[model samples]
Structure formats: C-alpha cells, structure tokens
Target: MRQDKNDHTNYSEVAQLRQQIESEYRAACEGLHGLAMRARHDFIQARMQRVEEYYQELSSIVGPEAAITTVIKINDAFAGTQRKQEPQP
Candidate 1:
C-alpha cells in the first residue's frame, strides 16, 4: 500500500506534462474549427489504432499543408520527450 516518495513526484510530473500537451493541442486546434469534424473522426480512429501517433495527427487537422507541418512540431517535441524518457539498451 506504500508508494515511494519519488514515484509520487514522478507521477505528478508526468500528469503535468500530459496536461500541458493537451492544453497546447487544444489551443493549436482552436484555429482549426472547420477541420474539427473530420479531425474528431480521425482522432477516434487514430486513438483506436495508435495512441502515441494521435497527438501528431490531431495537430495536423489544420488543413493548410504548411501550417500542419508547423503544428506537428509541437507534437513531435512531446513525442521526442517520451522517447528520451525511455531507458536505452
């Protein structure tokens, strides 16, 4: 029934990071209303498929090809963060 002190702290940090990612994604998606429906659908499907890739795909909902690339960077950065957190062999 006991958790390590560092475990609780690490869990909190991970929760905060997730909140930041979602908030930033929402802010980025605000300019993407017209694309929302298709995005919502794609998001669901993507979630059903690969959860990790969801953020990048959601970021790209903005139809403009150029903007999509720029937006995807946000997701990419977070993705990289997760990758770096993994232990290397």
Candidate 2:
C-alpha cells in the first residue's frame, strides 16, 4: 500500500500540541475573540475525530502501539493552516 505523505512520524509531538490546545480551551473565556476562538476549537475537534478514525484503521495493520508512535503531523493542524488550493479570480 502507498504511504500517505501527510502522516506524522512523531506521535509525542502530536500529544503535546493536543495538550496545548486543550489548556487554552480550559482557560476563562475572554469575550468576542474568545467566542470566535471557541468556534475554531470546535472545528478542529471535529477534524480530530476523523483523524482518530483513521488511526483506528491504521492500528489494525500496524497495531495500536506503532500507530500511536506517530501519525498526522500536528504542527500545521494546530496552526489551522491546512487548506486546499483555491482558484484565483
């Protein structure tokens, strides 16, 4: 099977980034920006659910231990930078 290019090779890093996002979410809300931030957080979370599903499938082949070792690069995902190219007008 072909390997996915975006797959992460460091699971620990992904865990760290996940922690950071969670901590920020747990902090007291700051108002308007906070509300928008919450929305963005929710969006990322739903995306994470999908990632989790993919991991589950991977675990079947590689075993959970290996699967968790690293998958899904977390840096750009946390930065909210993943996006499809849009045609310029």
Candidate 3:
C-alpha cells in the first residue's frame, strides 16, 4: 500500500536522524572531557549543558534504556582515550 511505503520512508528518515544525533552526542562527550582536562571551566560548563541536551534528545528518540546504553558506550570509549593519553610511570 502507498501508506505502508510512506511509513517505511518516514521510519528510515527517523533512523538516519537518530544516527546523526548519536554521533554528535559522542563527539560532544569527548569535547567536554578535553575541556575538563585543559581546565577550561567556562567552556566545560557550556559543553556540559550541550551534552545534557543531546542526552535528552537521544532519550526522546530511542527511549531511556537505549539512550543510557549509548551514554555508557560513549563513556567507556572516552575512558579508553583518556588512558591512552596518560603519561606512563
């Protein structure tokens, strides 16, 4: 049916948008971490606000569980990056 096709198209578009938002969320988290490391307090606060906004938007699109999972993944990835940057004793 035409309506079915339209629904599929809409779903595909939404999925694409969700992917874009997830990418942005990951980047934002990394940026926030970098700002903290550099002691940029004002920029860190602004970036933190942006990160929270991204989380809320992600939650609205994919529900709380999926959003939290994404956050966990991002945090784990960031942690790995942090370890790589640390000076070895």
Highest TM-score: give the candidate number: 3
Where's the lowest-lDDT run of ten residues in candidate 2?
24-33
State how far residue 48 of model 1 sits from its true place (Å). Answer: 22
The true-structure Cα RMSD of candidate 3 reads 4.1
Candidate 2 lDDT over 1-89, as tens digits, reads: 12443344334444554454433333312211344545555555655565666566656656788656545334344334313222347
In angstroms, give how far residue 23 of model 3 lies from its true place.
7.2
Model 2 residue pairs with clashes: 8-72
For model 2, what is the C-alpha lDDT against the true structure? 0.47
Model 1: residue 5 alpha-carbon error in angstroms:
0.5
The residue pairs found clashing in candidate 1 are none
Instruction: Report the error of model 1 at residue 51, Å.
Output: 15
Candidate 1 local lDDT, 1-89, one digit each (tens): 35687667756654554455555555444323334434555554443344334434434443346334543566686556656756799
Give me candidate 2's TM-score against the actual structure: 0.37
lDDT of model 3 at position 22: 49
Higher-scoring candidate on TM-score, 1 or 2: 2
- Backbone clash pairs in model 2 (N, Cα, C under 3 Å; residues 3+ apart or in different chains), count: 1
Top candidate (lDDT): 3
Tell me each candidate's TM-score.
0.36, 0.37, 0.59
What stretches of model 2 exceed 4 Å from their correct place? 1-39, 72-89
lDDT of 1: 0.49
Error of 2 at 48 (Å): 0.7
